[model samples]
Target: MSRKASGFTLIELMITVAIVAILAAVALPSYRSYVTRGRIPEATTALASKRVQMEQFYQDNRTYVDAPAGNNDTGTSTYFDFTAAPGGAETRTATGYVLSAVGKNGMTGFTFTVDQSNAKRTVVSGVPGWTDTTVNCWLTKQATSC
Candidate 1:
């Protein structure tokens, strides 16, 4: 009498492996995007906090220049670099200031800004599964506008 094998065959194992590989290929990019989106809060919240500081500075000094010490810093966040971008020689002016948070490490291609008008902008996005959108607002997720 012929007996049936009790274990999975090589074809079955290969099929399972292929399925796992395909799932991983699809899931990894999505998971990466989710992680990147989580980091976006760091930038938005930091910019909002800085805006508050700038407002307080304006209230005290009547201008946007000479922000308080360490006011421009995005502390302890490894995903972004903060700066005052400039078209002219000046970044901070009596009339206004522009704060920028640029992506770093795993967050490359992402940049954001908030100016004196309280305008929030997404300058660019390099996230694996996200569109930059730049819809005159901060993008906290892929294709979703804020």
Candidate 2:
């Protein structure tokens, strides 16, 4: 009976390992960027949903001053303080919504900004490594865009 080869040569195995390492090194950052990009939509969707809730609060409570009651699963039963500066928690007023979607708390990424009064929204990656911007792709109501 013929004997079968049992294992790879050391050089061949090393080369394969090195190639895989190189590919991973090249792909990791890109993958992270893609992930971060995906998160932008998540954050924006969350913001929009929150805005709708805030509007609903205004409709039901007749004022935007009170934080809504909490829901266990959604994590959005309360109002986000829109009073924070550009990159803080999303804020909403009875008349409009204002907030940023990324790069919060020193996170390095893009951010979504919505200035309801001007009907302006944008995505900004503040620095090259930090994608900071607004998600301006979706909008609702004349008072806001984000």
Candidate 3:
């Protein structure tokens, strides 16, 4: 009696590998974009919380300049470096503040900014759906208008 092959042939294995390669190539960028989008909230939340604290400081100190400058990560994020702008500058007081989160580690090509007016902006260029200009909309992975 003749027996047939019990395993995949070389041609079939090669085709499978090619299919996987193509799938990965297509999915990788989308996955990366999704991850980057997921990390955006870290910046937004940190900025929003800091904004509240700065407002409180203003309520007590009557200035946004003296509200201390530093990372306010709360040990929850590792992708971006947070900063409260105009922190303790010679001005001693600022009428407005700009909170920013610069991408760190492997999270490059993204910079998020928010001001006292709550105007959010993304300062990244060449991103698939992101604008390089300062927009009134929140910095998100999706292309949106403010």
lDDT winner = 1
Weakest 10 consecutive residues of candidate 2 by summed lDDT: 69-78
lDDT of 1 by residue, 1-146 (tens): 99987999999999999999999999998888788889999988988887888889889989877776224455667998777765421678888888888888888888888888988888665555676557678888776566
State the lDDT of candidate 3 residue by residue for 1-146, as single tens digits.
99987999999999999999999999988887798788888877877787788778878877777676433442556987776544423433467777777777656667777777777777665555455555665667666454
Candidate 3 RMSD computed on C-alpha atoms after optimal superposition onto the true structure:
3.1
| 2 versus 3: better TM-score goes to | 3
Predicted structure 3: lDDT: 0.70
TM-score between candidate 2 and the true structure: 0.53
User: How many residue pairs clash in each candidate at the backbone level?
Assistant: 0, 20, 0
Backbone clashes in model 2: 20
- Give the per-residue lDDT digits (tens) of candidate 2, residues 6-53: 988999999999999999999997775665555455555655665566
Candidate 1 at 43: error in angstroms?
0.4
Candidate numbers, best lDDT first, in rank order: 1, 3, 2
Q: What local distance difference test score does each model get? A: 0.78, 0.48, 0.70
Q: List the residue pairs that clash in candidate 1.
A: none
